[model samples]
Target: MGIFKRVKHMATADTNHFLDKMENPVSMVKQYIRDLEEQMGQAQQALAQQYWNERRYEAQIEETTALIMKRSRQAELAVDRQEDAIAELAIEEKLRNQEKLALYKTQHEATKNQTAALLEQMKRMNEKYNELVLQKQNLLSRIRAAQAIQASTAALQPYDMDRVHHGLARIEEKVWQVEAQAYAGIKAGEVLNAAPSYVEQEKRDEIQKELAALKEKRGTV
Candidate 1:
């Protein structure tokens, strides 16, 4: 059986899921460069194998050529001896070997073309990966500048003073309510830590009621 016999096994071999888990752009770019390097290595290895195969084919062709020439010389001797059948068989064997050799020659040419294309692709991938790395650094610097500017602007906002004063007013009112509730509980002869501020609630309610009564009185007038 060939490698990767099970279809499910092939899906796990891909690393896209793991690559997506990386949150940092710089780390992602670095990992991508590593993946490209591995691909480049594999392509170079294939090219080397093709180069070796081509050399083996060249040697095979030379060996076969020498063998044919030697047999042809032998055939000349056989013809002089008038052994026609033996010479015919020898020539036929040479023809078969030459045909096989030509097939290997064509295959070698195809492999050469494939290897050249792979090398070009590897070169392009390397260039693109380098460009991404450079761009990543430039982007990181700009991000830092943007973050610094945002922090500086937040630290120097005029509206922040209003926010602080509003918060302090809320806290002061809560403190006064607490004190009033404690005084009310003591006056009512209750053994309690505190209660809701009756005096403050009453005062705020009376003010609102008087404002409403004044509006009604003016409306009638």
Candidate 2:
């Protein structure tokens, strides 16, 4: 009866609602599983006891049937010997044995039925406990998945577009400064290469003088 009461609790419990309300659903579910196992153990013990009782009743019935047979034989022997009083007493004992046999048979049948019912109940409870175990595994998987999603979301929450854009802007500024320095160095090299040396200036002056002299000689001729 107590096991049935606990099984009723298991059957009526709302796992989803219960987990939703609990701060630690996993631990609570573990405890619930333990309770169910304990109740199942008790039920197994009770069923075993019922089976023992059924066997006892069967033995009693067998013993009573043997007694009935023995008394019948005694009555027949007494009648054959012409012992009228012994025959009557034997008949009476046989009738009492018959009554006892009937009672024992009835008890045995009743006990057998009781044992069967208990076995059915235990089978049902085992199925329910297995169902709960599967449900617990599913709930745990879902809980772990949810926790993983939450962790990923929390880890990414701090990186807003503004911060990302600011970092990119800094990198771009550095690149622009490098480009400007390179361009300044190239321009300085161009200026230094375009300037003429003193020897080249002197060579230019001598060429101009020779051209002027040639022009004057041609005009005189």
The candidate scoring highest on lDDT is 2
Tens digits of lDDT, candidate 2, 18-123: 8788888778878878887888888788888888888888888888888888878888999999988998998898898888888888888887887776677777
TM-score of the candidate numbered 1?
0.57
**Candidate 1 C-alpha lDDT tens digits along 25-76:** 5577676667666666766776788789878878877887788787788778
**lDDT, candidate 1, residue 37?**
64
After TM-score superposition, the amount by which residue 85's alpha carbon in candidate 1 deviates from its true location, in angstroms, is: 3.0
Model 2: ten consecutive residues of lowest lDDT: 1-10
The TM-score values for the models, in the order shown, are 0.57, 0.68
**RMSD score of candidate 2 (Å):** 5.8
Report lDDT (Cα) of residue 95, candidate 1: 83
lDDT of each: 0.71, 0.82
